[model samples]
Target: MDNTFARCEDLVFSYDDESRDVLCDVSLSFKRGEFTAVLGHNGCGKSTFAKHLNAILLPCGGSVYVDGIDTKDEERLYDIRQRVGMVFQNPDNQIVATIVEEDVAFALENLGVPPEEIRERVDEALKSVGMYKYRMHSPHQLSGGQKQRVAIAGIIAMRPECIVLDEPTAMLDPIGRREVLKTVKRLNREYGITIILITHYMEEAAMCGRVIVMDKGKVLLDDVPKEVFSKVELLKSVGLDVPQVTELVYELNKYGLGLDQHIITEEECTEALIKLLS
Candidate 1:
């Protein structure tokens, strides 16, 4: 009956005694197969939260649990990490193997999976991310997005039930960003993998079903994307942006044109305006 795939109970973390908490009373939970976006300005402890997902950082107070396995339990550490894989910001930093397929197979190899199974899973992972054609090529030759996909493939081959990405698109150009984002979305939809994406891009956050906004180590908003992003003034006050389409609708409303303030995309904005005109 327990549907929560991840949970943080009154989580608190601090670097040192004199330093204030980087995360304070951060209690939250995510359902299995849900795609959730975590958004905040720089130094808001978003990354710090991501690290706690896979036990990269332990809570100084309270506790974090992955599938009911507490992260504070030393024995469950590996089990927790295997259940929730992490993909960091930089693809270059993650790619260990020179060749694409080799990189994809890296994690499986580390886990002592059979060589034949590794090959099969590696191929599937690479193809799932749309990088199978470059399987034999060196990762250094691939574009930023392709490399990021490869990094994801490596995680996919591990068959983790969830992925926690910390600004995976931050280092990519527009095209690369699109590729990585699309890939992650597909992974969530087609594979039923839980996704926790940390991003500053309002557009990217708009794509998620749920959004969590944090500031100064505390969660400020937790709701569906529409409700979370509709608070234009509050989001701005905390140094975050609403989606462009939401902003456009807000401006139109300010000028006395009634429009749906929750529109998250240009297509939705156009539809609302058309309906308003009719």
Candidate 2:
């Protein structure tokens, strides 16, 4: 199996001819079945970059390829979209049908999938997100988390090779956020879907296999969570916050406390502090 799933080469994007580049000479690759989190402040071009993956936005210069299909080619547009699915932040905006199962079936219906296959796909998608039992329920009656899971199920029913979520948890409460994140992680782990999560939440980013920190439309850091979060000052310089536990250890180290350099999680911080005392 090939490791590379998505590739961007010298990708430059701008909204209009008069506007400056939103993404400048950005080149990166995402591996298959890897969960990657993209972190950046608003207007820093993370979402713009994501839009290129599905050809919602094409590069003003350079190129983007999803599963090796060039996005600039009109002939491959449908195939490119089928290979990558996108889920946005708002559940209300995403939900199209009244019933959960119907909403999941919407995309399949558009694709002209046979009714029998649509039923099988919808049921499998709903079950994958733990929302199978709620298939008959009205989408409006569901909680934010449940609605978002239904939204995800809609994408899953398409059976895309990759799923790109642009702040899918932004509008949800803590519980809703957890539910969506868990469902996404499960999709990557159990179903082997490549996940590209664009989020402002540091905690959410921590759960990814790789973290890419963008600033002023360019990648400033790309590394594993520990390495990326370790540079407390660098993250702050880019108008981003470290995870609470990481910040705590960083402040403690500033006061001459000895904690391991790689602490990113609360569990790791607690264990390190306990060992230090012992």
Candidate 3:
């Protein structure tokens, strides 16, 4: 059975005709329930490409298909967006309502969903993101991570099959970053929601099942995190970094320590080091 959820076919996009193409000949498919990470330096078109997934930005010369519906189809725009939700870098910008639960129900209310259903969905979404206790509180009272979770809850209330998050943790502190990442992982792992996370954090990318490295509006690499990060030189050439454990392993291998270059996690690196010592 074909499990493809969304796909971009020969996608070409640009801000304007005068500007260079931000996404050039980009073609990829996101399978159902897959957790994928997109990595790139600044202005590499990762965000531009993400916008196409939900019809926020139409392709200049090609097509973006969400569940077989063309994003260019004006009539199905709402359908496309409902299937694929987007979360951006700053949580403050995504939050609209002052109250947490109210914000989650905002979209549903606008869609004219039934009041009873909206209430049920809002509660479920808040609980899913572990922010149920803060539902009655004002969004401003919550921390950065909490705000982001509220943002995510708003999306979840819509029951999206896929989520495209563009650098969702960029403004968060180390602790906040961990909190958001944990919530994202649980969403993908437990709910079976397909995740497309755009981030510059190599460690966060390493946590994903798949990693796609983009440069100059093209995909430089796409594979499992271990295989993709193993090419440290190629990734570095594109101004991208590998996970810290992978970087350590790469340096050790260069010094003839013969460490495994594919070790992306600290636990894997520790095991390899212990074996080397033994």
Candidate 4:
């Protein structure tokens, strides 16, 4: 069904002739317009899993279906890529054009989209990412946050059904991180684009509708953010962290504060602390 935009079954992959699996029996599904975050410590295969969504890496022993088309089908690679756009850690690496708008139009142009349509798409995508006013400016002059937004606009110009961002904010400062995160959330809310964000930042994961935590090439937890972050010990055991607010509440709970361990945001933790004091 189209309602389910992406699906992966028993996905297995490894480098160097399949000697070891980076992703082990990983099966997940994404419904249309869902905003989900994937989290894990380093070398946990979260990025590897993201690559499979857009066919950057084919599954070794299983299948990945994007919009019901199999990713393993060599003939359908283009179709699969068109449906799921990928954004990566470094904006500098993704931005290839001199001007912002030209960069956004690059992908569609490569696809041989008509010039008129490419222009229209580029304008819309730039506006969506709040980068339209910088359209003609050289990308070298933009800030890190602005550059990353331009990169996102390029992906949006391709008109993909879903966007898979692998640590998109990792290379950014706080402001840059906020900018990219805000743009992605807006895309999900306004345009109903499915979002799969792979992030090391727990606060970013807290904003998503669902969280999937991977460890040692396998999914360790899959649930709503509050539920996933509540397992403080479990997450810490695997070298991962909860949002700062969640960690604060978790520590308070250990000291007889009796605060809800499920708090994932600063507001929630603050309210809980106030209630305990009262």
Candidate 5:
């Protein structure tokens, strides 16, 4: 069988030694070049699961493999980390160097990449995220969105096969959110990078190829955005709200409007409503 990019097989995890498992026998697979969104409420183990992808957290039971390399193997730790780069929520916490280019160069430096190669990779990464012009700027002086892009550039410099973002935009405002999301989507669509995004934002989740909804540490739903959002009751039960447009369509259907069940975008909803009226 061809090796998957990432796989969690019967995985179980818990921070407390004696507490119940935070992730209970959870199993999932992510192929290379796929964009996957993981959604769930707080304490639902979504972040914990993200940590496992890069071997930041080891499974209490079962296993997590990145490109068929077992995460439990200490010898493969560095290899797994280089293969799956992570970006966390807080931009402040992620920035290591004062200068934008220096921050982007940090990870590559640690990996002992040659100085000449580091400069090339850092420049490419900054350009990839549209932050090359800010390479000399101090990270503290940049706007929230710009800073977040620098953080993403830092990860990109590592040249990971997959990037796992854990609530990467949660700390940003609307503009920042859009900027980060657009950058991430472009990376997935254009560069063929596997992206596993863990977020609560319905709109961001909608942009992914597949959505996995978790509740009480287990996956309750795993399907395409349209199919997952169609389950209004199930999503609500897990404390998740569908995209506003999807909810509007669901409510319209309830009142005998008979709109297309797959209407997810605002434009689609508007067109469906017009057809219903006509």
Candidate 6:
């Protein structure tokens, strides 16, 4: 049984006829419950490619499918969006209601879901993101991370099977970034929601199960994080970086230290160094 939750096939898109293609022959599939990170420099078409997952942007030359439904099927637009929700870079743009709980319930209310069910979902979503205590609090009063969590709660309340986050932590500080990332990872690990995270932060990508590197509107690399980060020189050539620890290991390997080139985490790098010294 194939487990593809979303897919793009030979996708080719451009802003207009005069402009260059933003995505060229981009074909990839997201598995049902995998945590995948997309990495690329600015203007590398990572964000544009993400929009294709949910029909936000249509392919001029190929197709995008979610749960086997083609995104171009206007009749299934609602179905596609419900299955694959989007969380953009700015949380402020997504939060609609003044109250945290109300913001979470906004989508359900719009869909005309029952009041009782709405209440249940609102509470559940907020609690999932660790923000139930602030349910009645004003969203404007919360910190950046809190607001982003609330925004995410809003999407989860709608019960999306997958989430496409386009640089969700870009505007956040380190603490805020950590808070959002933790919530995202938990949702994928605990609830089995497929995650497609488009980010430039090497550290953030390192935490994901799979990493895809994009350049010039095409996929340059796709593999497990350790495998993808192993190509430090190639990534650097395309204006991308591996995790800091991966880079350190790569540099040490250059000096014949015989460290692992695929070390992507601090713990692994530390262990490798300790073993070498011992």
Candidate 2 Cα RMSD (Å): 1.1
Each model's number of backbone clashes?
0, 0, 0, 0, 0, 0
lDDT of 4 by residue, 1-278 (tens): 45899999999999876577899999899999999999999899998899999889998889999999999898988998988999989989999999899999998989999999999999999999999999999999998999989998999998889999989988899999999999999999999999999998898999899999999999999999999999999999999988889888888778887778889888887788788788
Candidate 3 residue lDDT tens string, 31-60: 999999999999999999999999999999
Q: How would you encode candidate 1's per-residue C-alpha lDDT over 92-182 as one tens digit per residue?
A: 9999988889888887888899999988999899889999999999988999999999999988988899999999999999999999999
lDDT of each: 0.92, 0.93, 0.92, 0.92, 0.91, 0.92
- If scored against the real structure, what TM-score would every candidate get? 0.97, 0.97, 0.98, 0.97, 0.97, 0.98
Candidate 3 lDDT (Cα, 0 to 1): 0.92
Q: Report how far residue 80 has shifted in candidate 2, in Å.
A: 1.0
* Clashing pairs in model 4, backbone N/Cα/C closer than 3 A: none
Give candidate 3 misplaced runs (Cα > 4 Å): none
Question: Candidate 2 on 119-225: residue-level lDDT in tens?
Answer: 99999999999999999999999999999999999989999889999999999999999999999999999999999999999999987999999987798899999
Instruction: Indicate the worst ten consecutive residues by lDDT in candidate 2.
Output: 12-21
Pairs clashing within candidate 3: none
Question: 1 or 2: which has the higher TM-score?
Answer: 2
